[model samples]
Target: MQNKTRYFIILLILVPVCFSADILLGSTHIPFSIFVDMLRGIEIDETWRIIITELRLPRAIVAVFVGIALPISGLLMQTFFRNPLADPYVLGISTGASLGVALFSLGGGLGMVAIISNFGFASSWGLIIAACLGALMVMLLVVTIAPKVYDTTSLLIIGIMLGSVTSAVVSVLQFFSNPNELHAFLMWTFGSFSGLGWTEIIIMACFIVPLLIISFTMQKPLNALLLGENYAQGLGVRISLLRFQIIIVASLLAGVVTAFTGPIGFIGIAVPHIARMVFKTTNHKTLIAASILIGCNLLLLCDMISQLPGFQSSLPINTVTAMFGAPIVIFVILKGRKSRLHYS
Candidate 1:
C-alpha cells in the first residue's frame, strides 16, 4: 500500500513534466519564458503561437488520451481472457479500423467512401464512423461466439484468424491503390498523435471517458474473473454480463484510439506488464491506476523522442513505441517461460 501510494504520487509529478516536455521540445523550439507568456494569454510571435497552440498542444492532449485508452483496453483484455498475451490488437479491433481506413482511402471513390472523403471535416468523421462500425461488427461477432466457446484459447485463436482475414483485405486494397493514395494510407498505419484538432479530441473523450468510468466500476467483477469463470460464477458474479461489458468497453476504447491515431501496437500489450511489475499486484484498482500513469508517461516520452530533437525530421509514433515496447514484451514472455520451466 505504501509503495503504491508512493508510486502514484511520483506519477502525478511526472505526468505534468512529461506533458510540458511534449509541448516544449518539438521540431521548433519554444523557449520556456515565451511558452509561459503564451500560456498566460499574452500575444506572442505568430509562428510560435500557432505551433504551440494549434500543433503541440493538441498533439500532447491526444497522446495522453491515446496512452490512457490503449493500456486500459489491454488490461481489460488480459483480465477478460485470463491470458497475459491478450491485447487490443489481438482481438482484431485495430485491424478492423485499418480495413475501414483502407476502404475509405483506396476504395476508388466508391459510394459512401467517395462522398465522405470529399468533405473536409466530414472526411475525418467518415473514418471515425467507419472504424467504429468495423470494430463493432467484430465485437458483436465475438460476443455471439464467445459464449459457445468453452476455452479462452480458442477465442484468442478466432480473433487472430479474424485479424488475418482483415489484413489480407487491406493488402489487396493497397495492391490496387495508386501510389499517392497508397502513400497516404501507409502513413496512417505508422500512427501519429499529431494532426488531431480539438473536435476529434472531444469526440475521442466522449467515447473513452465514459468507458473508463465504467471500467473502474467493474473492478470487483474483474477481480472476481481472475480466479476463473467457474470460480467467478460461484461467487455470484454474472459471467456473461461481465464478459459482454468488458468487450464493449474494450472495443470502444481501442476502436476510438485506432480511429484517430492508427493502430499503436506494443503499448497495449506491454504497459500492463510494466504496471504489474511496478505495483507488484494483480489488483485491478492499483493496476488500472498505474497503467494509466505509466502508459501516459511512456507515450509522452515516445512522442518527444519521435520529434528527433537534433534533426528536423520526425519519426513515426508507432516506430518509437514499438522500438521500446517490443523489448519489454519479449522480456515478459521469456521470463514467463523460464518460470514455467522451473515449476515444471
Candidate 2:
C-alpha cells in the first residue's frame, strides 16, 4: 500500500511535468525562460504566444484526455473479456468510428449532407456526429450480442468480424470518394492531436469525466471479476449487468476519442498492460488510477515526439504511439508465453 501510494504521488507529479514539456517543446522552440514568463502572466512574443496558446496547448490537453480514455477503456475491456489482448480496436469500436467518419466524409451523398446541415452543424460537427453515431451503432450491436454468446472469447471474435466488415465498407467508400475527400479521410486516419480545439475538448470531457467517475465505482466488482466469472457471480456480482456497464463504458470512451483523434492505435491495447505490470496487481482501484496517469504521460510523450522538435515536418501522433506501444505489447505476449512454458 505504501509503495503504491508513493507511485501514485510520483505519477501525479509527472503529470504537470509531462504536460509542460509537451507544451514547451514543439516544432518551433520556445525557450524555458520565455515559457515561464508567459505562465507568470508576463507578456511574451506574439508569435510565441500564438504557438503556445493556439497550437501546443490544445494538443497537449487533447493528448492528456486521449491518454486517459484509451487505457481506461482498454482496462475495462481486458477485465470484462478476461483477455490481455482485448481493446477498442480488437472489439471494433475504433473501426466503427472510422466507418462512421468515412461514411459521412466520403459517402459523397447529398442526402446525408442535407440531413446534417438541417441540424445547423458545420462540416466538422457533422463529421463528429457521424463518428459518434457510428460508434453508438456498433455499441448497440455488441451489447445486444453479448448476452447471447456463451463465452467471452466468442464475443471477442464477433467484434473482430465486425471490424473487418466495417473496414471493408470504409474501403469501398474510399474507392468511390473524390480525390480531395479521399485525401482528407486518409489524413484523419493518420491520427492527430493538433486539429482539436476547446469546443472538442469540452465535448470529450463531458462524456469522459462522468463515465470515468462511474468507472471508479466499479473497482470492487472489477476486482471480483479478476477472480473469475464464477467467483464474481458467487460474490453476488450481477454478471450480465456488469458486462453491460463495462461494454457501454469502454465503447463510449474509445468511441469519443476516436471521433476526435481518429483511431489512435496500440494505446488502448498497450497502456493497460503497462499499468498492470507497473502496479504488480490486478486490483482495478490501483490499476485504474495508474492507467489514467500513465496514459496521460505516455501520450504527451508521444505527442512531443510526434512534433519532431528539430524538424520542419512532424510525424503523425498515431505513428509515434505505435512505435512506442507495439514493442511493449510484443514484450508482454512473449513474457506471457515464457511464463506459461515455465509453468508447464
Candidate 3:
C-alpha cells in the first residue's frame, strides 16, 4: 500500500516535471525562469513562446507517449514469455515493421501502389499494422505449437526464425531500392521524436491510453500468469484467453509506437526490469504503473540528451535509447541473477 501510494504520488509529480524538462532541455536550453514566466502569462517574446508551444511542446508530449507505450509493451512481453530478457522487438514485431518499411521504400512501383491504396500510411499505418499483425502471427504460432512441442525453447527458436524471415525479406527489399528512396527510408529508420506533430499525437493518445488502462485493469490475471499455465488455470484464470488479451494490448501498443517512431530499441526490453527492481514484486498492479512512469522519465531524459549541446543536427532518438537500453538491460540481468542467487 505504501509503495503503491508513493508511486501514484510520484507519477503525478514526476510526469509533469519530466514533461516540462523535455520542453526546456532541448538543443537550446530554455531556462525554467523563462518557462515559468511564459506559463504564468508574463509578456515574453512572442516568437519563442510560439516555438515552444507549437513545435517543441508537441515533441515532448509525444516522447511521453513513446516512453509509456514501449516500456509497457516490454512489460507485457516479459510476462507473456515468462522470460526476463524478452522484448517487443525480440518477438519479431520490430523486424516486421522494419520489413514493412523496407517494402515501402524499396518496392518502387509496389511501394507506390501500397501508398495509393491508403495503405500509404506505410509511413505510419503500414508499419504499425504490419507490426501488430506480425506480432500476433508470431504469438499465435508459438502458442499453438507450445502444446504440441511441449518446449519453451522450441517457441524461442520459432520466434527467432520469424525474425530471420522478416530480416531476409527486408534485405531483399534493400537490394533493389533506388538511392533516393533508400536514403529517405534510412533517415526514418534512425528514429527521432521530432517528427510527430499534433495529429499523430492525438492518434497515439486515442489508442495507447485506453490500452494502458486495460493493461492495468487486467493486472490480477497477469500476476496469476507468473505461476505457470496450469497453476494459473487452477486459480480460475483461463490461460489462453489471458495470454491473448495481453498480446493484443501489447502488440497494438508496441506497433503503434514503432510505426510512428521507428523501431526504438531498449525501452521495451529494459524498462520492466527497472520497474521490477524499484518495486521488487511480480504484482502486476504496482509493477505496471511504476514501469510506465520510470520508462517515461527515462526516455524523456534520453530524448533531451539526444538533442545535446553543440550537436546541431541532433542524434537519433533510437540511438540514444539503444545506448541507454543496452547498459540498463545488462545491469538488469546481472542484478536479477544476483537477486535470484541470494533468494536461493
Candidate 4:
C-alpha cells in the first residue's frame, strides 16, 4: 500500500512534467518563458502560437489518452487470458485496423475512397472510419466465438490465427498496390500522434473516457478473474457477463486508438508489466491506475524522443516504442521462466 501510494505520487509529478516537455521540446524549440507567457494570455509570435496550440498540444493530448487506453486494454487481456503475453493486438484488433487501411489505400480505382469521401471524410477521417469498422468486425467475431470456447487458451490461439490470416490478406493487397498508395499505407503503419487534431482528439476522448469508467467499475470482478474463471465464479462473479464486458472494453480501447494513431505496438504488452513490477500487486484497482500513469509517462517520453531535437523531421512513434518495449517483454519472459523453475 505504501509503495502504491509512493508510485501514485511519483506519477502525479512525472506525468505533467513529461506532458509539458512534449509541448515545449518539439522539433521547433519553444522556450519555457514563451510557453508560460502564452498560458498567461499574452500574445506570442504567430508561428510559435500556432505550433504550440495547433500541433504540439493536440499531439500530447493524443499521446496521453493512447497511453492510458492501450496499457489498460493490455492489462485486461493479460488478466482475462491468464497469460503473461496477452496484449491488445494479441487478438488481431490491430490487424483488423490495418486491413481497413490497406483496403482504402491499396484498393485503387475501387471507388472505396470516393464513396467514403462523398460522406465528407475524404481525409484522415475516412481512414479512421475504415479502421474502426475493421476492428469492430474482428471484435464481433471474437465475441461471437468466445462463448463457445470454455478455455481462454483456445481463444488466444484463435485470435493469433485470425491475425495471421488478416496479415496474409494485407500482404496480397500490398503486392498489387501502386507505389504511391503503398507508401501512404506504409506511412500510416509507422504510427503517429501528431496527425490528430482537436476534433479527432475529442472523438477519441468520447470513446476512451466512458470505456475507462466502465473498466474502473469492473475492478472487483477483474481482481477475481486474476485467480482463474472457476475461482472468480466461486466468488459469485458472473463469468460470462464479466468476460463480455472486458472484451468490449478492451476492444474499444485498442480499436479506437489504433484507428486514430495507427497500430502502436509494445506499449500494451509492456506498460502493464512495468506497472506490476513497480507496484507488486495484481489488484486491478491499483494495477489499472498505475498502468494508466506509467503508460502515459512512457508514451510522452517516447513522443519527446521521436521529436528528434534540432531536426525538423520526427521519428515514427511506433519505432521509438518498440525499441523500448521489446526488451522489457524479453526480460519479463525470462524472469517468469526463472521463477517457475525455482518453484518447481
Q: Top model by TM-score, which number? A: 4
How accurate locally is residue 181 in candidate 3, as Cα lDDT from 0 to 100? 65
Rank the models by TM-score, top first.
Answer: 4, 1, 2, 3
Per-candidate TM-scores read: 0.94, 0.93, 0.86, 0.95
| Candidate 3: segments with Cα more than 4 A from true spot | 1-12, 41-44, 109-152, 335-344
Task: Estimate, for each residue in 221-245, the C-alpha lDDT of model 4 and write its tens digit.
Answer: 9988877899999999999999999
3 versus 4: better TM-score goes to: 4
On the 0 to 100 scale, the lDDT of residue 305 in model 3 is: 85
Positional deviation of 256 in candidate 1, in angstroms?
0.3
**lDDT tens digits by residue: candidate 2, 1-344:** 68888888999999999999998887788799999999899999999988888888989999999998999999998888887778888889988999988888877743344333333222288889889999998889999999999888899999999999989999988887778677878888989897777888899999999999989999999999887889999999999999999999999999999998888999988988888787888888889999999999999999889887788877888899899888988887798787742111
Order by lDDT, highest first:
4, 2, 1, 3
Instruction: Report the C-alpha lDDT of model 1 over 230-273, residue by residue, as the tens digit.
Output: 99999999988998899889988999899888889999889999
**Error in Å for residue 19 of model 4:** 0.6
Best by the lDDT measure: 4
